[model samples]
Every structure is written in structure tokens, then in C-alpha cells.
Target: MQITHLGHSCLLVEVAGRRVLLDPGTFSSFEGVEGLDAVLITHQHFDHLDPDRVPVLLERNPHAVVHADPESVRLLADKDIPARPTVDGEPFSFGDLTVTPVGAQHAVITEYVPRIANVGLVLRAPGEPSLFHPGDALDAEVPAVDLLAVPVSAPWCAVKETVEFVRRIAPTAVVPIHDGLLTDPGRGVYLHHITEFGRDGGVPVRDLRGAGAVTV
Candidate 1:
């Protein structure tokens, strides 16, 4: 499988002969990104799914089907765009690629803010290692997978929990996500800790911020 980070949480993943794009939000850049077989949005947050930009992307790729969380689907319906609700334990198939959505709740930020639905994804294809992308939550139940996209920095995220999550999951490799809020220097500092954790846990940390299309 091959994955490319287009900034923030957006990932252009190629696996099982299919090209799937995940979370093209406000922080991510997908101006000319095309040939998408499918688009997976974990929630309705603008950072994860841009309200204005996503429709343009779907318009560009008319055949691409969008599978988003239930609320996100409803919001898209208001825009006259059709979308399927991706829920917990539900599996969606994209030819050879099978995506299983898990976890239905986003991480809590504060008591004042309402919690939203966030679905983590597990992608598996024949003879390929399963890839897990936990949208905006860390407490999601994740099974063993070869590659895991771990959120490194966010308002609700802390360095301790970040390292603990990685240490607990202990996936073969990890890719950093949800880091658009930080500057280059700040992002480097966060990645440094996560990288060291991955190294100590015997897991390789793969940061694909500037690097293009990496096979995992």
C-alpha cells in the first residue's frame, strides 16, 4: 500500500489497485487532486471535511463515492450531494479494498463543547496489511494493523496521551496526522517525541509531510 500526506490529516492512499483519499479538509491542500475512487470523511468538522471545497473535489471526480459519519452525510445532503453514512462495525467495499468503520464518538475537548461523532477506519485488502486511520479520537478500539495514522497534535491532544496511545497500540509503523495547527518548528518538536516513542516501542515512525507516495 502507498500513502501520501497532503498536509494535516488528509491522506492520499493507494492500495489494492484503488486510490482513496481521506479527510481533505481546510488545513489540507487538494486543489488538483483527482482520480479518486472514494472519499472518506470521519466527521463533520471543517478541518476534517471542508464544507465548500469537498463538493468541488467530488464534482471533479464525479464517480467518487463519499462515505462519511452520519451527521456529515446529513450536512452533505443539504448541499444536494449524496453520501453514505459510515457507522461503527459497518464495512464498506471499494472493489478489492474493504474499509471497516469503528468508534462513533470524537474525543472530548471541554465540558462546554458538545461531543460529535468520529469514526475511525480500518482498510484491508488481500495480501496487504490493514491500515487504521482514527479520525479525531484516540480511545477508539483498534485491532492489530500494519500501519496506523496517529494524531500527534490537536487542541484536545496532549504529549503524554499521544505517546501513551502509540505505546499502547504499538503498530508496526505510525504516520503523523492532525498537525496543521502547529508551525513548522512546533510540528517538528511534536514529531520528534512521537518518533522517539515509535523508535523505543520498536515501531518505525513514517512522517510523509513533504515526502510523496510512500509504500508501507
Candidate 2:
């Protein structure tokens, strides 16, 4: 499988002769992406689901089916974009790829902040390594995967939590996400720590901050 880090949590994943775009939000641009088989969204947050760009995506990839949580589906319906509601543990097929939704809610930001629906996705294709993208949450009990998209920076997460989460998942490799807010120096600091710490645990973490495609 090959994954392109568009920016932040958005990724363009290609596997099993199909292309799937995950979370093409405000932090990333999907201007030229086309011929996608599926689009997976974890939540309704603006950073993960931009109102302006999603419609453009639908227009470009008219055949691509959208999968998201119930709340997101309702909002997409208002824009006349049909979306399937993702149910935890139920696997949905997109050509040769199988996507299973995990987790039920977004990570809590604070006591006063109301939690929203979130779903971490586990994707697998024939003869390809399994990959997991955990949206904005870190509490999901996901199955073991070859590649894990880790949240390196966020309002509800810290460096310590990020390290612990990577340890719990124990993936073969990690691609950092949810780091749009970090400056270059800040990103470098987190990347250095994660890479050094992950190395000790037999996991190689790649910093895809401003790069192109990387095979997994």
C-alpha cells in the first residue's frame, strides 16, 4: 500500500488497485485528487471535514462513496451528498479493500465540551499490509496493524500521551497526523521524540510533514 500525507490528518491511500481518501479537511487540499473509490471520514469536525472542500471532492470523484458516522452523514445529506453511516466492527468493502470502523466517540477535550461521534478506521486489502487511522481519538481498542496514523499534536493530547498511544498500538510503522497547528520547530521536536522512542520498541516512525508518497 502507498500513502500520501496531504497534510494534517488527510491522507490519500492507494491499495489493491483502488484509491481511498481519508479526511480531506480544511487543513489539507484535495484539489487534484480524482478517481477515488471511497472517502472515509471519522468525525464532523471542520478540520477533518471542511464544508467547502467536500462538495468539490464529490464533484471530482462522483463515483466515490462516502462513509462517516451518523452525525456527519446527516450533515452531508443536507448538502445532497449521500454518505453511509459507519458502524463499529462491521466491515464495508470498497472493491478489494475492506474498511472496518472502530471506536464510538471523539476524545474528550474538556468537561464543558460536548463529545462528538468519532470512528477509527482499520483498512486492509488483499496482499497489502493493514493500516489504521484513528481520527482524533486515542482510546480506541483497534486491532494490530502494519501502519498506524498517530496523532502527534492536538488540544486533547500531549507528547506523553502520544508516546503511550503508539506503544499501545504497537504498529510496525507510524505516520504522524493531527499536527497542523505545530510550527516547523515544534513538529521537529515531536518527530524527534517519537522516532527515537518508537525505535526502542521496534517501530519506525516516519515524519511525512512535507513529503510525497511513501510505501507501507
Candidate 3:
């Protein structure tokens, strides 16, 4: 399988000769991205699902299946974009690729902010390494995966929590997501600690900011 970090939390995952784009949101520009077999969203947050722009993306990839959390499904439905709900533990198949939705709630930002439905994704296929993208939560009991996309920076989490989340999963390698708002130096600081403290302090951390398509 191959993955391309298309800015922030948006990822273009290509496997089994199919392309799946995750979270083409306000933070990421997926204007030219096409030929998607599916468009998977974790939540309705603007950074995860840009309702205004998603319609355009769907229009571009007319054949792409849309799957999102229930709340996000409603939001998309309002825009006349049909989407399937990504129920927890339920799996969706696209030929040889299998995408499973896991987790149910977004992390608690604060007592004042009401939590929303958020579901992460676990993707796998024959002859390819399994992968997990944990949306906005660090507390999900995710299954084993070869690659784990960690939300290294966000308003609801700290660098310490990011490192611990990686250790808890203990994947073969780690990648950064939800870092759309960080400055270069700030991003450096978060990754510095994540790399130094995650998984025996030696887990391979891949920051796919400028690098092109990465084979995993």
C-alpha cells in the first residue's frame, strides 16, 4: 500500500489498485485529487469535513463511495451529498480493500464543549500492511496495525498524550496528522518529543509534509 499526506489530516491512501481519500477538509486542499474509490470522513468538524468543499470533491469523483460518522452523514445529507454511516466495528469493502470504522466519540475538548460522534478507520487488504487512522481520539482500543496515523498536534491534545497513544498501539511506524495549524517550529517541537518518547523511544516517525507518495 502507499499513502500520500495531502496536507494536515487529509490523506490519500492507495492500495489494491484503488484510491481512498480521508478527510479533505478546510485545512487541506484536495482540489485536483481525483479517481477516488471512496471518501471517508471521521467527523463533522470543519477541519475533518469541509461541507462546502466536499460537494465539489464528490462531484469530481462521482463514483467514489462516501462513508462518514452518523453526524457527519447528516451534515453531508443536508448538502445533498449521500453518504453511508460508518458504524463502529462495521467494515466496508472495496474489492480487495477493507475499511473498518472504529471508535465513537471525539476527545473531550473541555467541559463546556459538547462531544460529537467521531469514528476512526482501520484499513487493510491482502498482501498489504494494515493501517489505522484514529481520527481525533487517543483513547480508542484500536487493533494491531503496521502504520498508525497519530494526531500529533491539536487543541484537544498535548505532545505527551500523542507519544503515549503511539506506545499504546505500538505500531511498526507512526505518522503525523491533524497538524494543519502548527507553524514549522511548533511542528518541529511536537515531533521532536513524539520521536524521542514514543515506543521505546525509537519508533520510526514519518512526517509526510513535503515528501511525495510513501510506500508503506
TM-score of each: 0.96, 0.96, 0.98
Task: List lDDT for all candidates, in order.
Answer: 0.89, 0.88, 0.90
Kindly list the per-residue Cα lDDT of model 1 for residues 1-216, writing each as its tens digit: 989999899999999999899998999998788899999999988889998998899889888999999999999999988999998998989999999999999898888999999998999999987888999988877778888898989888798888888887778888889988899999889888887775574568788898988888
Give one digit per residue, the lDDT tens place, for model 2 in 1-216: 888899999999999999999998899978899999999999999889997789888889998999998889999999888999998898899779999999989998999999999999999988899999999888988877988999889998888888888888889989889989999899989887787776574568766766787887
Q: Specify the highest-TM-score model's number.
A: 3
Residue-by-residue lDDT tens digits, candidate 3, 101-125:
9999999999999999999999999
lDDT for model 2: 0.88
Question: Any idea what lDDT model 3 has?
Answer: 0.90
- Report the C-alpha displacement of residue 67, candidate 2, in angstroms: 0.3
Model 1 steric clash total:
0
Error of 2 at 98 (Å): 0.5
Q: Candidate 3: where are CA atoms >4 Å away?
A: none
